[model samples]
Target: MNAESRDRLRVTVARSFDHVVMAMTLRGVTYLGEQRAPYNEEYDGNDLVAASHLIAWRGSEPVGVLRLRWFADFAKVERAAVLPTFRRHGVMRALMQEALRYSARRGYRQVLGHAQLNRVAYWRSHGFRVRPGRPSFMFSDYEYVEIEHPLERPANAITMDSDPLAIIRPDGDWDRPGPFDRSLRRAPRKQRRPEELA
Candidate 1:
């Protein structure tokens, strides 16, 4: 790794416009330009959310980006991409480590990812394993091998509220309510009565 990559590797949960722009540029180059995935699939509305974007920067330029979507039991780690020039320079590894740390802090027990078919070994090296009985997910042109990484952390960890990138802040005051578990769940909106509709 170069001195800049090793010494100045900075990872942040991106919410600022400037950082998001840099992240989108890098991801566009890798996922859209090189991989030739459809733009809709690559962008996939993840960047629009505040907390889903994780960017790794060297100085002011973003070199890598990753997205994490939380579910009831585990977090989905996806949309990882690194600029061509920065690949193999430790940008991806730095971003992955940071993502894992953030997940642990959020009290997530596991992190899951769909690693590209060719990049199975890379994900495996980071402690992601193929979940037993689950098959690889196919995405039209390419296949994504499923992988999961368990995070060991205290159940009381409540760091998500303090994270500015989080889309949903914890309910009530963090200091007073004490630690709690939460997952993103949406209930169906109530519709007008049948008579009103008629």
Candidate 2:
């Protein structure tokens, strides 16, 4: 499949409804580890659901993922990940452009994202300005910066029709849990040791 078809990007509300959450988590951990950043294996599907999840797939397999949430006046973009084989083919750019356009349509005045330190310049090229004198999210372990873009009327008004292959369901109701919820709920919790707790 070509890059565009391989991406097969779709926006949805439920992470558990689709099987790509596992692929996204694995790719995130692997990518973060390569950059010497922290990756929590215990991260739950709830985190993915809280944000608007966009997933890209190649045929039946997921290859890229991104998340976005509207907070007051701005839309916060997070967790943009594209597999190594899918990178540099304008995948991330296409995703971001779509997100910005979506945010504008939803009445957001700005779009913001916490850019990993290494990607600051890349974001700058997309018209994001780095804020000065703001507290950093990464603390001392790794460098990270906040980037923001003022959505001009022109860019915000553009819209693209949704893709059919990216459509997981007809009603766009992905918030409901799938088989994972039933299995996790059935699993017994581990008992704590008194000495270990102390």
Candidate 3:
């Protein structure tokens, strides 16, 4: 892709159901259609709970997706997919970088993923390495090995010390005021008298 076109690619958290659907569509095309991965195995019940989806958009086209699930001290990366047509343009790399940044911002120091045996080198290119001594495993007719990447905690990572409003801001959008922040502008409700309550 040209520099101008590459510059148009933006990775953002999937904040709404529509955004999640777009991510699912890319995964469906790549995994379900191309790879013939089983539907149950691919959509493993965890999508809507305790997970953050990242979508890479080249202008208005949703070209790539990555799912991140948070753990106490680590973040698990799963279901990374990019449209076949967009594979050579660094869409996966962009998604990986955004996932790392988002994880670090939330105070996660390690990121883990199950890399298909054939894709180990691709994961390694992004600084992930197979965990030593971990046995290879198989799922959905594919062999996989666990890989991990370490991250340095960012200085601005959210913590108990952060402002309460900042903590409640939308995922990966802590820098801007969110709907809750804007709602603070409304006047407080007046207290009802005992006579009015009766």
Candidate 4:
């Protein structure tokens, strides 16, 4: 964005009906229309009722959008679509930072995204890491990598493998505990006292 447009950038949670439409409109244009992303694959059923959207606006015109869906152990951020004109202007960054804070405050342990393979560097720049052994997604023109952002890891949190799998799971969503949380429950090895051993 240019300096003037940068000053006008604003991001917010979709509060009203119109705001929701704006989010969808931006998504439709970028994902469905511009990239020609498969309509069926693009329109996952989680939108609207089960997800909340964040929209980046420049003086009332929506320019970027992303959706957040709650999972058992993390928040899944998906379908991030930004206007071609706004691609390098930090709009997505502003929206994602706010979403991360919001998810962390709501007691989520982490956030995950199915990021396009080519944009791996961009996502990494935002503190997202590709887990070891993660699956790669193949679409018409893009492959995806699962990226993660751990929120408030305790000192005792289990150390992830040098490479982890694509794990922010979708099966047991919202309320149900899922298989992906197994590693998180691993207890740190107990240290033995020298006196006891003797």
Regions of model 3 farther than 4 Å from truth: 1-7, 190-198
For model 4, residues 50-114, the per-residue Cα lDDT tens digits are 68888888775788998999887888998888899878889889888877876775567899988
Tell me which of candidates 3 and 4 scores higher on lDDT: 3
Which residue pairs does candidate 2 place in steric collision? none
lDDT of each: 0.76, 0.63, 0.93, 0.77
> For each candidate, C-alpha RMSD in Å?
9.7, 12.9, 3.8, 13.5
Off by over 4 Å in 2: 1-16, 19-23, 26-29, 32-49, 58-61, 132-137, 153-198
> Which residue segments of model 1 deviate by more than 4 Å?
1-7, 49-51, 159-198
Please, what's the RMSD in Å of model 1? 9.7
Clashing pairs in 4: 131-164, 132-163, 132-164, 132-165, 134-166
Error of 4 at 16 (Å): 2.0
Per-residue lDDT of model 3, residues 62-181, tens digit only: 999999998888999999999987888999999999999999999999999999999999899999999999999988788999999999999999999988999999978999999889
- Which lDDT value does model 4 have at 50? 61
Please tell me which predicted candidate would have the highest TM-score against the true structure. 3
Off by over 4 Å in 4: 1-6, 153-198
TM-score of each: 0.73, 0.60, 0.91, 0.70
Candidate 2 lDDT, tens digit per residue, 1-198? 787765565433334654455545645654565544555532335454435766655555665666777587788887777877777876677667777766675557798888878889999887788877886687436678888988865532323443322223322332344444455568688998899899
lDDT at residue 82 of model 2 (Cα atoms): 81
